[model samples]
Target: MDYIDSICNASASILDMTPAVRKPEEGKVVLDYILDNCAKWPNKIFLTQPMGGDEVLNVTFSEFLSESKKMAAYIESLNLPAPSQIAIMSKNCVWWLMADLAIMMSGHCAVPIYPTLTAETVKYTLEHSESKLLFVGKLDTHPWNEMKKGIPAGMSCVSFPICPSDVSYDKWADLIGDNEEIKEIKKRTPEEMATIIYTSGSTGVPKGVMLSFKNLTDTTFGLINTTHATENDRYLSYLPISHGMERWVGECLPFITGLHVFYAESLTTFVQDLNRCQPTLFLSVPRLWTKFQLGVFKKMPPEKLQKLLKIPFISYLVKKKLLKALGLNHVRYAGSGSAPLPPDLLAWYRSLGLELLEGYGMTENFNYSHMSKPGGGRVGYVGEPSEGVEQRIAADGEIQVKSPGMMMGYFKNEEATKETMTEDGWLRTGDKGELDDAGRLKITGRTKEIFKTSKGKYVAPAPIENQYISNIRIELACVGGRGHQAANAILMLSEDAKKEAAESGGKDAIEKELEELIKTVNSGLDDHEKLQFVAVVNDVWEPENGFLTPTNKIKRARIEEEYNPLMEEWYNSKKKVIWHKW
Candidate 1:
């Protein structure tokens, strides 16, 4: 059977049966639910952050509302262009949410850019939105300055610190000033555009997905049909707010559920924050989940871990201990999306008493589509559709979605917008998938990245690439064989893994060990699926260097471009067996 057939079978065995779907009541907007619920659950924790030397900051629903109101007032006072756009260029932070709500309250649209966005993309976003103000975060100022040339003159720029030279610049503090007489703007129409989230254009210029308040609210509440959230549930907000998954899960869901949200201080402190928060709920992209699984593999050999997992009594004890150690003992609902998840990683986490519900959605729909049941998770598939959304397999197996969360349209690009929507309005997901008799969705490779080798056999890069990176030492993997004789992969090794190998043994010994790793990864694949060459570089793929996303996912296109010059050496030379040849 082909890989898609294999995935379909594998998914059915795990994801086919889940909780009965529950449809949410129609006619609710996210902003309405947030304001109403906040008034009701005033003391419920809304937003949390740590400011003082690694200490975590916690804010209640009342405080979040108050702060949001203050920020709204200041935004209103700005008196810029009417119905203007507010752009937030920052990572995941409490201030990002504050800025989002402030924009909404001021009757404006929000454009949240990815923190790892190229200066060109950033400038494009600002210009595309025709933003009246930029609420710059306390981030590396270099990118802002780099893109300053792209900033439209008279398109006012104000850093969050809102410095002295920043004429009439607004600080977060300005939101809560003594001026309490701010006029109330009417509640947003359900159809009003609330946010414009730019898709991470790992391919090209990022497209702004214009979402209405209704889109978010409907999807979020619809997801709640499968979730059992309470005012007491604790949520960790570590994922980038710019992404629709995080925005809906970390922000929109919290508003309706009244869950406590603790924002991580920074990327370096995320794990520490997770431990400190001990959140009952958490959401992560498959890439990060893969990283964590790799971290675990680094400490314990995969073979040994697999062996230990098989011993019945020992497996129970090991999982219990690991869950308690990771503070995931109380995780009621853990989830992953944005990319396909490796089944091995998914099963390993499930064994640890964590039910990570792998789900699916994209920017256009505000990430409200399908999710696995808490206990009934399907590792390789993003399960059945949620309440109120219809799922259908298109002619070519692309998952077609029609949800209330579907975007208003693509900002500044009407042609692309029309192309994205179906004649009858189903949003084309661009992902290939299959559904079982039970309606669970199993995703195959992306339609875009399926490449052909010299023999004309197709290679679905992600699956093969995921297997290679399972070695723990390989941090980034990009697979391709298009325009080549055979399929090959370029892998960037973990920095620490390289140093560890060198310290433990010599360069030659490490080289041999890496070859063994490649052989092991290759042994599991079919002839066409096996990699012909693997480029294992010792250097790190950093976001600062444009090789990674804000979420630390590899930039496949960029990696391919940078390594195109080395392809001949990697393939033609016998030294290509191990990547150190270059």
Candidate 2:
């Protein structure tokens, strides 16, 4: 069977499955949503914190409300300003949400810092945001020790109930202990600042995007309309809640949808946690999706699985078994965003009965822009502009958006803000995209990432890289040939691929396989866009290594800078593919 064509035909007839449009309640903030839900379903499990060994800690809606109120009362007792700026640097946990709610209910703006950031960047965010108080939650002891040194001497610090060892600070428990529940929560206007989220700093210094209560509420409603999530829906919170996309969907969406949110205990236990929660809504970035694909290939070789899947009866069983093994059988809605998801990956999942949708958004807009419609699965396009979102392709090909969910602007960066917006008030998305006949948005590449070759032809690397990354063996691919004859690629092998190479015919066989892969990819590209040489690097691209942003996007400029010096040497060697020596 021609699965691709079959799937496309099936998808063409799939109608939009979203629920009827229900306008968001007027003049209500996220806190109000939580409070209302608590009143409506006091005993509903609001959050589940997974503990290793099959143990879990669940918090009911009423308990969450009460604890948050007590924490808010304690925050008010500190006598801080009405709109104090507080920072939370932690991984996803129950305490993180508690601190976030407390900060908001206390009429303070929350500044979320990615726990994976370097100490220098962490300090920069703390100092740049001018945060008055810092809530230290789940973090690595060594990094926290290093980061704490940079905190201002007089800044108040509070530690979550469970924190890194040897960290001496005010405990969150002390703040809530024996404290009277705050009878009245501070009322915040829809336009008031709710949080200042720092970007992942892939290219340069992270900018603080100031999102208002209106932005959050608008995005929450927009997502609800798109995904049709319900109170009974379960969501696994594994992605860093610090990310605006995750914050809006994984964290804030629950407040309005009344979804039961589960926290992944750690990376090692993610698969187990996923099985335990059986989340109906699963949101992940491209990298994790790629990793999940790799995990599947590891269990069953691609050739064998493909052959087996050709049998109609076997295909159903195969997909069911595979999805169950991956703990994704119950995922009613699965989405990939933050970075581009390869079309092949999307189709592959669709073939297995999981419709993985592509979404597009940025922190500036609180992540409400475009998403693939429930059943309108246009393969490469991130479906039509979301309800109430206006989008256009500029003459330069940049995608621009006008939405109610747009951030107020980058905090304290008026000049930068002015540069990001057009005279007509549309926010510059920096992404180059095209709209299909059906009005689905297909992102071509980043405007800044397009590079010119010596022949004066411009090359967009993302599409080219996507083809190479579809191969499970390749973990990352960076295509560059600025001022050169043709583009070259830097390939990072997946751990399983590396192990296979070592166990099989070693580097020689790996190079041969990669050359064939490159040839296959090049056949689909234009003459100016074809790669001349491919360089394989043994290093892993990770957030800690500064090669990837917290959201798992590659730092292209940084990668180019690190490898540009070796380009000429690799080219002069006359090898079709060269392995870079450290």
The lDDT leader among the candidates is 2
TM-score of 1: 0.88
Candidate 1: list runs displaced more than 4 Å.
1-27, 54-56, 140-154, 158-169, 294-317, 504-526, 580-582
lDDT for 290 (candidate 1): 68
Off by over 4 Å in 2: 1-18, 141-146
After TM-score superposition, what is the CA distance of residue 269 in candidate 2 from its true location, in Å? 0.6
Q: What is the TM-score of each candidate against the true structure?
A: 0.88, 0.95
Per-residue CA lDDT of candidate 2, range 1-582, in tens? 000000111232223443587667789878888878999999988999865577888999988988889999888988987797999988898889988988888889999988777778888999999998999888766556766766777788999876786767899888888888877788988989999999888778999999999999977887777666789888899888898877887778898889999999887888999998897788777778889988888788888988988999999999999989989888777877666667788888877888877777788888778777667768777777788999999999999999878889998899999999999999998889899888888889888889999999999998898888887778888999999888999999888777876674688878888889889988989999999989988778887667888888889988998999988888888788887652
Clashing pairs in 1: 49-57, 50-57, 70-175
Count of backbone clashes, every candidate in sequence: 3, 0
CA RMSD of each candidate after superposition: 4.7, 3.6
Query: What do the candidate models score in CA lDDT, each in turn?
Result: 0.70, 0.83
